[model samples]
Target: MSGENGNEEESRGLKSLRQLIRILSVKSGIDEAMADDLFDFLLTVDPEKGISDEEVEQIKGYKQADVRKVFRIFYDLRIASYRRGKHPDTGATRYYWYLDSRDADLALLRRKLQVLEKLKMRLKYEKENEFYVCPKDGARYTFDYAYEYQFTCPKCGTMLVPDDNSKYVKVLEDRISRLEEEIKKDERRVFGR
Candidate 1:
């Protein structure tokens, strides 16, 4: 019974270890064959069954820093890492990797859609608004309000300048427009219309 239990434990451990390796490899953006080769190499070389800097470099054909960088990309994307732990002997940081069981590609798509929707709403509001500025006092106003008040600086009483150079606001408007266009493109791709 003890032997059977031990064997089962070992088998489960091996399977989980393999899964971790695959996640790390995919997150690193390596091709399937290369990632597999790298995974095998790392597993074979890890003294504590935890990947280390030196082993990562040798397996991934990168410097220690570079190999770690590939993993960091996944970190930035929030799509990898099961847990953080410290190395027992060296006290170096280690991250256990996990392939997100959820559909990561679809998640990314949904996130993009949400962003696009927000941008579209903002753009809709901006398109309805026009901006103006006072040349004398540098006061800003919306078009209709400014016109109603005769484009005069409330503080300095100077004629307000047409604020065509609201560069930052214009940039935001441009970004929103671009995002809206992208959303339309994505919709077309999805619905073929």
Candidate 2:
């Protein structure tokens, strides 16, 4: 039935959104428990009439400060948004928060692009540099640094040896290629191209 299909699609979207929140939380160094709680609470908010942080605290039994911190992180990531409004009873200004569905894909695409750029930069560095390693301490250094140190490990005083980084370079190149392909797919999906 069409209703069943719609429900399935909605569930899939929810799952994706949850995964995105988890990834963003880890990337931002937020506690996993807080992120999980925040994600669950956000799901209950009405998109059109967003919920206030105080309401979230009252309903979910979370500390207002902690809820605000998670909301602020989501706002920074463009996953959540808020609007200023006056409380009807108290006439006090309040921020009502809701998920920004329109910007979710854009935010994900932007994050992928950022990661792709970093991978490309690292690939370039790997290809251009000669590396040395300390066998005892497993410390790695660039040729210039190794030369300055007389090819000796600073921590353990072990002699440094040339590191064969061809395999590592290949791995980075592969990752870069895969990420580029994923970005292309996401762009097409997001832009309807």
TM-score leader = 2
Q: Which ten residues in a row have the lowest lDDT in candidate 2?
A: 1-10
**CA displacement after TM-score superposition, residue 130 of candidate 1 (Å):** 3.1
How displaced is residue 65 in candidate 2, in Å? 15
Report the C-alpha lDDT of model 1 over 1-193, residue by residue, as the tens digit. Answer: 1244444443463445446556766666654454444434433332234455555665566676655555454445453344567877898877654423223323333445555556555555566678788877678888887888898877788888777745665877788678767657655654567
What is candidate 1's local distance difference test score?
A: 0.56
Error of 2 at 92 (Å): 40
- Give per-model CA RMSD: 18.1, 15.3
Q: For each predicted model, how many residue pairs clash, with residues at least 3 apart or on different chains?
A: 0, 0
Candidate 2 overall lDDT versus native: 0.78
